[model samples]
Target chain A: MNRIVIGRYIPGNSFLYRMDPRTKLIAMILLMVSVFLIQSFIHMLVALLLVALLLVFGGISVKRVYLGLRPLVFLLIFTFLFQVLFNRQGDLLYSLELHYTVLNLSIAMALVIMWGFTKRFLRFRLLYFLATVAGVFLLFHYLPFGIVLGEGTFSVYEQGLSTAFFIMVRLVIIITLSTILTITTKPTDLNLGLESILRPLRILRINAEEIAMIIAISLRYIPTLLDEANKIMLAQASRGVDFQEGKLKDKVIQVVSLLVPMFIISFQRSDDLANAMETRSFVPGQKRTRLHILHWSGLDTTALAFTCAALIGVILLRVVGW
Target chain B: MNMIDIENLSFTYGGKVEALKNVSLCVKKGEWVTILGHNGSGKSTLAKLIVGLLKPQKGTIRVDGVELSERTVHDIRKKVGIVFQNPDNQFVGVTVRDDIAFGLENLRIPREEMIERIEHYAKRVDMYSYLNKEPQALSGGQKQRVAIAGILAMRTEVIIFDEATSMLDPDGRKRILSYMRKLRDDGVTVVTITHDMREAVQSDRIVVLKDGEILKADKSEDVLKDKETLEKSNLELLLPLEVLHGLEHKKSTNEEIKEFLWQLSLNG
Candidate 1:
């Protein structure tokens, strides 16, 4: 079977694809910090606009971002409603009978969040960033962008729109960076780089070799685990396990049933692994050679330099009280 | 000196079922010994015991002069490697190269040495090209070959194959059997536990097992000629018997009548 490309990686050779994973990871961190530092509404708008430009350049579809955010839409709405109703310090748009606090959906907080998302989109690829931009644009166009609903007479549509946009933005940034990292870097190099960066933990007596082994195994097992889960689900479905006919509680139980067989299969695999290792005269704590060696190239250096620059810029902007 | 020595060795599971009883066996260095039996005839149990995977309830098992006990079992295990029947179950590493390196790692071999040994053994098993391929993605034969490489990389002087080829296709089975013969020729003690009569006939010594006991231990010719013993043990015979049965009957041989049975039970 051909390799699966489920995550955000589009499998291309663009500049983003050639960057080191460590660089991409640091860039994500820098972008996240920059999101919180911009104080002026115009600065936030500029950040958002930069994100839009990035989305276009990255060639990611807007629909992908929305799809990534689809699962979080509910939580986004729930949080938005909670924030607007409970945050009573702002100018009262409406008052709820349940409490003396005025429901002030703070426009500043909402706009800051939106601005934060725009910066994220700029940092990553286009697919999800575009989706989020479209979702938020449509949301602001319809919903009285900053209207707070009282408890007795809340606008579900307004809450949904606000929540969806926030969620879409977060989803777009995380998915974009994550996908970009995975696509740009092989699993082996990524783990090795992570191990090298984490070498300071050697003071705690942590074995880097063992940690590397665990990471390699876990990464390798992800697909195997997914395959096993699918098999178990199908097998349970054949046995009349009604996965679709469940409330939240029933669905959880159905999922637990699938875990039983997956655990069994994994345990069996581990036992086999133990024996296979024994046969190979493998001794723990022994030195080993790696067949594939990953070196930091010029591209890696440039990528890291670019990420460092971004971080430094964010710190500078904050110091200047931007 | 015998490479493997088993004297009055008996193994019981959970102190209830006796898997092997009063089993005494000896194999010279580089000898190829095949244990033949029906399912649950204690062949697998004995193989596990020899490799220190299971402790003997009574008596002793020694490999390369080191006794297999709680104290020395670890050392014995390092010297004696066993390939199990299921290729899928025996893979330690996700990929062929990694799996082959597993045993070497356990032995604390240096990184450079492990790499050198992995390359050599993988090449020996003809799996050098698949060193990077996922073990789960390989064919049964390829998987078995990788397993063999995993064991061989450890450089165990005594290797036990516990129905290692049973799950393999005919080609895979043939490939492993030939490899076993080659290993035996290279002065490695090779013990094969199998139900395949054809494989048994090719061994230096054939030990028939039944009901947790050794029924017969002799040269391949002697064991293959015993049709009565084969019938009692629920095993079929192989080779020359099938040809002889066809000649005597002037008709097609009975498909159910095993090849070995044709020699002793053709007219009975």
Candidate 2:
């Protein structure tokens, strides 16, 4: 739980840290849009280079960026695999052949095989997933035991591989840039920055201040709630919840045990917080001042201008068939 | 002048459970009053009542000469602050500095003065260096200290601590109690709601609550002598206090009781 570092701010005095939050926020949006605009492999590589440069100039390490992407490793790999396997455009790269005789096996034997496969899959999920994909292709290419579907050929496409690679790169760039923004900016500054940027939405009958306050409060409580949930987990463990060593049914029970108490504790906490805020004279929609007033310095303007130029350049490149 | 005055305060939860019943108490300015009670006793309820967190069904609370009502509660809150139990839940800011600034921001203090008060109170609580640290990164005691600093930054005349040290370890609790003592010395009316007899003994006055009613209210020394009241409140006496009480029951002199406790400590 402690390893989950999303939306956490690390204090630093780097160039990114010194930039106004509004500048960074706007720059983040532009960078995010530009990442999706990446069309060719060369554009993806250039985007990666720009991201690395930003990380270096911002005094953030590559390992830190990798750490930010660590939690999404499984999802990224899953998406990559789905895109690679299902996509059938472009030249064939390789083919696989598989053989299995399900018709010859008895029902009991089939159940045993399925049980063994399940055990192995649970133990080594990622490896088992790759194996399953390979097994499917091999079965289509070689096996003719029960029924035949089509040409019975399983082939990989260059377009599939490239598309998968592009998507993975896009996801990594977006996540890493977001991580950089959050890591460099303080929560209060982020709140104020978002509030000021969204201040124009007041004309649309939106409560930007309240929305900002909600976001700020949620950010503030994320780590705190995580800590409380950790404590509750430990307490339940001490009471023999057996979370780590449990059957599927037992695990469900243990999870419910943890969640129920967490929900109760959080509700009680919100009540206390409401009272505390009220006692502190925090009225919703009231004009409130902040201790840290954001000042847009020369660095902020330059950063914003650079992001806008980069965004326009990307759009221009795409429009002019570069 | 009385900093907090409660008259016939009664509160019920869901019209069934009486949390506080006809609880009336007066705390003078600069007085360090500790409310002692066991679990489910009405002390926490009273603390909430004083801070205007909960409205009494039939009573009145006056803080610093301002009556506490729906209209006047905000004004009363300006003079009365509370640091509740569960240090994690009470902290409203992501960082220590921001937490201290929370109350100040609510009061609309200017940024310059907010900075000054955040620094001053954080230093007073010895949490100046940790101003940038997240609340979750700090120990329970450190968080409680930050909570106190947050309240102090508001410059409230009376600060009520609702079991603030109940969640802390011995060392942490001792550190917080020392801070509370410092706050008392600085002329802040400190109301501590706790069941720890040791903490109660350090206060200027101890009010024992039992079954949603006041069991005993007296000076710390006088209250410590009332074994019946302590027993009724289910508040355990310290080992030394227990020994002293045992010796006093046998009609021993103060010197003899002290000598006996001393010898017992040495022998043990």
Candidate 3:
């Protein structure tokens, strides 16, 4: 559950945290655009370094940034493999004959080996996945028990590696920068920033304020809904609904039981909330003043100016074909 | 002048279930009143009605001399604020300070004044240290205290606790009750909707509701002494109150009754 800290804000008074949310938001957008625009690995590395410096200045720990990236490990690995395997333009690093039957053993022995590997894979997924990938390549190189079905080769292209590395760095930096933004900015300020950024859409009759309110309420309710769902799950577990250990059918039933009650509770809660909001004079689409009026400080101005200058530099490099 | 005045209040749920029927009550300015009832006894409905959260089918509710209606609800709400039963559900903000500022924000209070009120009320509820803490991180009692602080920040003349302590433990309940006492002492009108006889005993007056109608409304001690009315409402006397009631024939003073209970506990 702690791993679901993507949208949760950690209160702080660091330079990045104290700068206006509008500045942070604009910087995030410019940095994200710059990350995608940088094609060369060196440029990507520079972008990553800039993000790293921002993280340092923001008082965010490397461990926290790494934890934020944990959920993306599989995506990173998948993209890396996709690039490595599919990009056939690369020069061959090694070649081998892939045999149809690598295991020259009795059925019982094969079943035992398969079972052992399956257990290990289930227990240590990431490590086992890497090990299995390595073992498959090793088997292709070394095994000579059966006839070869086809020629298999491992290749690493200069172009593919550079592209893959650039993509990976871009993704890591974007995610880290965005995480830092959310970690520093409070939800309410984020809502206000979004509203202000999108205020131009109001001329197109888009109701930006209402949209911002929706985002703000959704952000506020995420933790609350998670807590409620947790309580419902625990209650169902107490009633012998084994969510962790059960057949698919049993798990479905357990999920349904938890979800149904949660939906009902949420509906009731929304009703009460509507009444409460109404009593508190929260009229939809009506103009309301804020208690925390966002003011642009000199720090915000400097931060925005730096971000724009960096963005211009990235653009200049691209235009000049650096 | 009446802080809150209700005349023949009747409310139905979706025109089918009657939640309250022909109930009327009044609280004088700065008075402490407890509305006591069992579950499904219309106590919460009455509280909501007074706070203008629910419209009555037939009745007039006035808070600070302003009649409660759709047009006047916003103004009425300024005069009266309610702290609801579920602390988690009622909380609209992620953190304690944000929640306390919520009402003040709606009222359009200036940022500096909102901050001052937040600090003052948070300190009043002894939640100053946890002002930045998320509502989920707080205990049930702490959350309720934060809710109270939010309402207190509104600076409403009439404050309603609609089963606010029902979800809390004994210690939390005591802590909230003490706050209610403090509010009363500060000349704020307090109306606590509760089924807890112990809490009712501490109020200046008690209005007992049964089956959506007012069964009895009187001084707290008089209401506590009415065994028939208490039994009819399915309200039980607190243990000490029960003991005190048993010695009513002996005409014992409250201090003497307390002394006897202490001696009885010592003997045990």
Candidate 4:
């Protein structure tokens, strides 16, 4: 079998791909700080442009980053709605007054939520969701009665719109930088870099090696644990447990049954692993060495310098009160 | 000196059930020894005791003349390593090269030497092409081979297989058994703990265990011929007697195999 492209590492030999993982990790952190430092639209525009340049250099398409953000669609929409509805500052750019049927609106909202929750299990989802929303509004004229809320006025301010736009831009910049980091570096190398960064905790009597081992082992066992969970789920399914179609209560019970066995299996595995590690001559907290030595080259230096300059540039913008 | 010497060794689970009781055995240097028994027959317990995974309550275990104690057990483990039954549980690294490098790293072997030993042992196990592949992507047979290469690269004088092939398929079992043959040929003292009679019969000597005690210990042929003692020990002869003997005398191969194939196809 071919090698699994572990955790979003797209195989390519771009500038970011050739840079050291530690350099990339540090650069990602610095750039993320730089993103939040921008105080004005001009700086936000400049940040977005720099991030776009990074995307091109890393060979990642903007469409791929957009796909990665798909899972956060609901969260992003919620943030936009919350920002638009609540914030009242600066001049009122838009204002509206309307009387609404509180009862019918509540009923429509309840039905739309039901559709949202159940759509995951349904094959034909978009039609149900669209019908539930569109049907309620289309039938509004025919509805018999409604509990009318008095006329309510709401205003959208200039400052509110600007804040919403700023927050959205900042989020996109951070996520894009993260996407570049994840795509360019292997997960193992990422962990190795994290371990090297955490080595300073040794003076506090905290074992960095143990923490790193814990992380590496957890990462290693994720697939094994998933495999175990799958087998347990199958065993439960053979006994006629309906995991696919369930009410919230039934799903809770079903998940408990799976979790208990998964816990037992993992505990037993950990015990066995202690013996296995011992047999391999792994003494806890003992002096150890590494096979993979991190190398620093001119490429890494250049990459680190770029992130540092970006951070400093952001600081300079902040000082100039932009 | 014996490669491994155990005298009157005993281990109890939580101070109630005896896993191994008063069992004494000696493995000569470079010899392959198989501890064969049924499930719950304490064969695994004995292997763990020798490797210092568990402390023996009664007597002494000496590996190459270093007595196993709290102080010396770590050093003994440095000389003896084990490849366990579950290939998934035993794998410790993300990839084949990393897994092999793990044991060497723990032993504090330097980087360049570690790389050389990793390449050599991986090629020996026919997994050099899969050095970058994760353990989850490999089959049970391939993972077990990586486990063996890990122990072999540590340069341990003694290596134990604790029913290592039990979870593998027939093809996987055959591959592991062949590697056992290679390890024995390379003069690494090999101890194979198993319930399978086929795997047991390949060892230089067989020690049958029943109820946490040694039932019989002798050469492979001697133990096989003594069906009465084996039956008394309550181990089933899963291998049919005539076929086992037929396989042993490999020169009578032509007509016997043909007849067996005819019988097999007819039965099918």
Candidate 5:
């Protein structure tokens, strides 16, 4: 529950940190759009090069970059596997044959069980996952102890592999770009940038300042309320309320018992917050000053112009079917 | 002139029940006043009313010579800040620095000055290093200090602590009381609303409230020594301290009082 990968900042002295938050936000969006415009190997290579350049300039080590992608490893693998196995539009590069027998199946199951047991005890989990896969495949191929239950053959296509590779690369680049943005930018600075971006909404009679204040306050309270919920859960657990293991009906009741108190406390908290805000002389939608004044320097302008040009170039590439 | 002056103040919570009834009180400038009451005795309500968070249905409440009303409430709030009870709920910023700037932003302070005041007040409260820290990363006492810093940054002449130390530990309570003493010494009017008798004993004046009415208002020693009125308001007297005060007013010493108490018990 505590493993939040995004919106977490690490203090550093780097060019990205010096850039205006608005510039970073806009540049990140533009980069994401350019990433999606990749149509062939050339575009993919270009995008990969840009992401690598950003990684270097971000002052983040390769290990930290891998750590950033750790949470999405499963999704990346799933996408690759789904594309390779299901999408067959090109000539077959290789034919794969498989047999399922009692001996091999049992051995595979044992390997899986072993992996699960040793997962927490191991440090290099990616290597463990790969090792387990190799062990299962070798067992299925070389060992034959009982009657074969089933046999099948599947073909791997050239196009499917290419497409999967492109997709996985795109996802990693996008996620890594976003991770860099969140790491470099402060949350308060991001809020200020969002308010600035949403300033034109004032023409629609929507107060962007009030919306920003709401978002800021909500972000401020998220950890606090989560702690409160944890406390409530523990208190309920001590009272013989089964939260983790119970019948479905009993679990639902337990959840309700937890949620009702949380809701009551949140409501009372909102009341208290409203009164406190009033006492602080906060009037929503009123003209108020800010503490961290965002200055859009010439360098920030140049950065945004560069990203905008990159976005336009990518769009042109897509339009020309490159 | 009184820092806070309330006359014939009456407040009902949207016609639910009367929280304060015809309450009248005067707090002198730079006075450290503690309002003592049990739960539901309208102590918090009075704090809110003075800060203009709640309107008095039938009375005039003035702060720093300005009457609190719809037109002047904002100005009054700028002059009189509050440190509420709950540290989590009242935290309006994502970080200590931002939270302290919250009130300054509302007051339309310039960016440079806001930073200066935030640093000044945060240092004063010993939270300078926690400026970039989130409220969740802080203990209850630290969060309270940040909350107080937020109020102090507003440069309010009068500060109200509405049961601010109720949720803290002994050390936290003592730390906050010392800050209160410092603020009063700096000529800032401090009104602390609390149910702790020990805290009331340290204030410059004590105003005991009962059923939304001021039962007794006197100097701290006088009010805490008045066992009859304090008991009527569900309060207690620090008897040993009172006996010492009795000696203060006369030529008696601690040994003599001990001897007399021993004789009385023997006779009984």
Candidate 6:
């Protein structure tokens, strides 16, 4: 109940969890590009297959991965319907004769593309070499590979495939890697990493310590903030302030009420934190001790190596026009 | 050495509501002093002043013979740690251990030493098992314990409990008071701002506050026995202490008061 929807990390000791956060971050960027770069259905299908295999290797349960995606199911459906209706120029498979343009390739392509993009990868694994090749295959599958739109040569399938797949791929890549990083790294270690990584910013006179302190304080208050939100939600619900029971406007009003209290709580917490920090000798450049030590082990090195390999392999695949 | 000395201390919030006026007192090193004041009697304000959280408008505060000023506030803070009324609000760390580590981090102690200090203090406060638990999930008593551990972990000589036990249930209050006595016996200078005279009567000294001014400051025995002075401050004198004193004098006229006095004499 205290867990936040964002930055919610579950601690585990799998191979994915042990990777260096920086490596994970970079690999995610590469994976996103590869996922969207493929065009044909065969490529997408293969990509999904690769993702599934990685999910098994990464040791994250499929049930948990699916649960994470549950919240975005509506968005996925909306995107599919959007592509099917707005996409024109493909053979008109089914039209109700009432201001709706539905194309054959759009419907089948949307489902296959969605499935191709979602499988295995949602669970998060290291499959850079195969995934990129599969992505290229998917990229060429629906995009007017050997055909033209008869004259002007505008293929809806090609445009939709490139645009939709790229957008979905980017979104999935960011979300999955972030989840992977958060679930693996303890928050205190994450702060330390941020501090060490941003150390070079000292040359810019950016006051890295101050920025790191803000992030650490914000992270520390996560549970307290969640508790405040839940308390407001329950209090409002008891008073018949039913957000789900009302029209859009009423729901918005209810949400506003909840947000107002949450904001107030956050301000109060921050004030308390500021006072606490100041009293505890939290002066800039003050020497301090840490109770927890994060050790970079052999596992971390191996994970980093794997992540870097995946990233370079994906880029090479792209370079070679695979 | 006097742990803390306050002379003619006065404070106002926004130049309107006066929180404290002409408050003067002294707490010797290792003395357990209780400041008994009801709501708005300026007890907490005094605690804040001693810990350098609030600036005195018209007085001098000296901690360990060093005058408290803006330049010396940090030094005063290192000597005195305050546990605020709301344990939840006063805590800066997510977990009990982390919260204790917060102060150490600010002090910039080495990592190895910080871990040793945290465990030591957490054990003293009997919160060793809860080192990793979040403060919010703890009961009021447990939260207070964590708060104490956090302060004690810093190894400050003087500690101020500003209604630290008020949020607790009866049992929790009892446990905290017991721990406080233990701390006192261990030679830590403790300044507890409380309205609980039962606990106050057991302290080394008691300072009564009324209407933002010091009503009385004396040894607990003398202060607790001064019924007229206490009643004037809207604070009831402690029954047991009064009974024992009355019995010593054999001066009570009321039958119940007489009986209580008589029982005290017999017990003695």
Q: Tell me the tens digit of each residue's lDDT in model 6 across B142-205.
A: 8888878878878889988888888889998998898889989999999999998877866899
Cα error, residue B99 of model 5, in Å, equals 2.2
lDDT of 5 at B19: 86
State the lDDT of candidate 5 residue by residue for A1-322, as single tens digits: 3556566777888888899998998898888888888788987887898888887887866566677788889889879878888889898987767778998999899999999878878898877987898688677667756989887665679999889999999899888888888788888998899899889999999888888878878777777777888899888888887776677899889888988999999999999999988889998778899888798898898999999999998899888987
Where is model 4 more than 4 Å wrong at Cα? Answer: A1-6, A61-67, A88-163, B242-268
Residue B261 in candidate 6, Cα distance off native in Å = 16
List where candidate 1 sits over 4 angstroms from the true fold.
A1-168, A237-257, A286-289, A292-294, A297-301, B69-78, B105-120, B239-268
| Per-model TM-score versus the true fold | 0.72, 0.88, 0.88, 0.88, 0.84, 0.80
Candidate 4 residue-wise lDDT, B19-44, digit = tens:
98899999999999999888899999
Q: Please give, for residues A1-322, the per-residue lDDT of candidate 3 as tens digits.
A: 6478687688787897888888889989998898888876678777777788888877988887788898888999889778776666656654454444435223324544665558543866776667756676666566646644455566666656666777778889888988898899888788889999999998899999889877877787887888888888888778877777677898888888988988998898888777666656567777765766688999998888888888898889999998
- Candidate with the greatest DockQ versus the true structure: 5
Error of 1 at A275 (Å): 2.6
Q: Write the per-residue lDDT of candidate 1 for residues B1-268, one digit (tens) a residue.
A: 8999999988888888878889898988999999999998999989878876677888988888888887887688778888888877766565688778777766767878889999999889899999878755789889888878877887888889989889988999999999999998899989999999988877899999998899999998888878888989999756567455445665444553465365456544
**Could you give candidate 1's per-residue lDDT for residues A1-322 as a string of tens digits?**
1244433234455666565665666666667666555544565556566656655665655565555555555665556556554544434454323211122234334554776556554644344544554454344433442333432333234344443445445545555455545655666556666666666888998878678777767666666667778778888889888875657898998978988878888898777666556445545555655554555578768766765776677678778886
Model 5 scores a TM of 0.84
DockQ of each: 0.36, 0.62, 0.47, 0.73, 0.76, 0.50
Write one digit per residue (lDDT tens) for candidate 2, span B1-268. Answer: 9888889989999999998889899999999999999999988889888877788799888888888888888788888888888887778887899888888888999999999999999999899999989877899899889988988999999888889888999999999999889989999999999988888888999988999999889999888878788887777667777786767677477787777778767855
Worst 10-residue lDDT window for candidate 1 chain A reads A95-104
Best by lDDT: 5
> TM-score per model for chain B alone?
0.90, 0.92, 0.91, 0.89, 0.89, 0.89
**What's model 1's lDDT at A280?**
58
Fnat computed for model 5: 0.94
Q: Looking at candidate 4, what is the lDDT of residue A250?
A: 97
lDDT of 5 at A168: 96
Candidate 3 lDDT by residue in tens digits, B149-227 = 9889889898899888989999999999999999999999999999988888889999999999999999999999888
* lDDT value, residue A76 of candidate 6: 63
Error of 2 at B38 (Å): 2.3
Question: What lDDT does the true structure give each of the candidates?
Answer: 0.71, 0.84, 0.83, 0.84, 0.86, 0.73
